[model samples]
Target: MFTENATLMLYVENVQAEYDFWKTAGFEILSKETIMDYDTFDMKPHADSTLTFKVYDKAFIKQISPEVADFQPSVLFETEEITELHERISGLTDNISPITSTPFVSFNFASPSGIYFAVKEK
Candidate 1:
């Protein structure tokens, strides 16, 4: 059985930049530390879940597990004001896709390290 204390870890090349992006997007940083040669930042996406950003040596990751270097997870954030969030993210990065309205209003944006995530209306 699993508990509500779930965390999604994202591996990135630049830890500070990714951390700044998430912080600028209004995610609160809980803690940051370096463990086992990897720099990790714990951020609160909501009250119950945490989103972690880990910075590791690319070559070392490739040597240990090549597939890990290319991993990109699709993370979604629920927002009540989609347009406001979209505008905020659009001003920060140019990697945001146009908001679509097929099933519901949603759009995806990329961090400086090229990790893509979506914000959907709640």
Candidate 2:
């Protein structure tokens, strides 16, 4: 049996850009670390954090790439104001689109850094 859940992680070329992307998309940053000269970024999170994203450099990937990946991260938010959140996000980022209802009531959008997200009513 599984002992715990998993977290999504990504290797990014730009740490600040990726971090800011999640912030704008409504994720709270639990913690972060950066190397001034190396331009390296390491991020840690609190146990209770709902959504967490970590951005690191290619060098970091060199060590973990065999097992890990350079995949993009996506997180869905459950919301009652799907319509409003969709419109508000779209207003700021052209990548956002209108709500798409199917098996579940939801709206889809892209973050400033190009991560796709969907919001559903729970």
Find the candidate with the highest lDDT and give its number.
1
Q: Which portions of model 1 show Cα errors greater than 4 Å?
A: 48-67
For model 1, residues 1-122, the per-residue Cα lDDT tens digits are: 97645666577788878788888988878888865666667788655554443445454466667877777777788889999999999988999988888688999999898888888888
Ten contiguous residues minimizing lDDT sum, candidate 2:
38-47
Per-prediction TM-score, please? 0.82, 0.65
Number of backbone-clashing residue pairs for each candidate, in the order shown: 0, 0
Clashing pairs in 2: none
Q: What does candidate 1 score on TM?
A: 0.82
Name the candidate that leads on TM-score.
1
lDDT of 2: 0.61
RMSD of each: 2.4, 3.9
Model 2 error, position 103 (Å): 2.9
